[model samples]
Target: MDIALINPFLAAAKHVLKTMAGVDVRPGKPFLKKDDLAKGDVSAIIGITGVASGSMALVFTEKCILGIVSSLLGESYPKINDDVRDAVGELTNMICGDGRRRLAADGFSLQAGVPTIVSGKDHSIRHFADGPRLAVPFETDHGAFMVEVAFGKPH
Candidate 1:
């Protein structure tokens, strides 16, 4: 995979979190995923095709996502209900859209599909493609989260 592709996601994620959720996210070092099991409690996944044939997953702990929804809506949600799920979907879409826009600017035109959210203890994710998956972890004041991506860069 081209290393350049990951920068868009990192930049977009930081921007989205600070703008939408009023949370500041600090990115950790990027690494390759070593297992299928996810580290977070909830995840929003969006498929990416065209120049990038794969998917992007935004994974968050229960506390982190709930905090995000609460900050976004100006309310408190103690559990992961429908409202919280909807907000996760919206967050996934926003991050994906922002990253895709940057990819377009760099000539990687990708079409993103609808985001699907799944939450449960240890509910794992299998990436869409047969390529190396990159995991970028982020830390916030409230909690930590990460984005995992498996995309085959255009030759």
Candidate 2:
């Protein structure tokens, strides 16, 4: 695994939530994900290509996302509506962009595709890479979420 590509995302997730939504995030220990099942009620997935190719997913429980969007937009979200889904996509894009920027400083060249949203119970996140994904779970006052990254070979 190219762990060098993972740290930046962890940092980016924490930074994005705190800076944009004012939500302080606590990241849990990262572990290898052996299944495709998403950890939350909603997920934003983006494909990455360049020095390495793979996919990144930001998964959020309904309550966690509700709290985040509420804080981010200064409006209450009673449910996971279109607005909430849009927020998930935007957040995924920003987090990946920030992570790519950081990696660039270390000589990595990466580009991200548009994010796609998936929501429901027991939905699977089929990553671009066919292997165990690095899953990093996060917690906030409202609820918990997770970030998963699967890396492929360097191009």
lDDT per model vs. reference: 0.88, 0.94
- Pick the lDDT winner: 2
Give the alpha carbon lDDT tens digit for every residue of 1-155 in model 1. Answer: 78777789888999998998889999999899989888998898888888668889999899998888889999999988989888888998999899989989999888989999998989898778878899999998878899998877422
Q: For this target, which candidate reaches the highest TM-score against the unseen true structure?
A: 2
RMSD of each: 2.1, 1.6
- Compute each candidate's TM-score over C-alphas: 0.95, 0.97
What's the residue-level lDDT of 51 in candidate 1? 65
Q: Give the range of the ten consecutive residues with the poorest summed lDDT in model 1.
A: 146-155
In model 1, which regions exceed 4 Å deviation? 153-155
lDDT of 2 at 50: 91
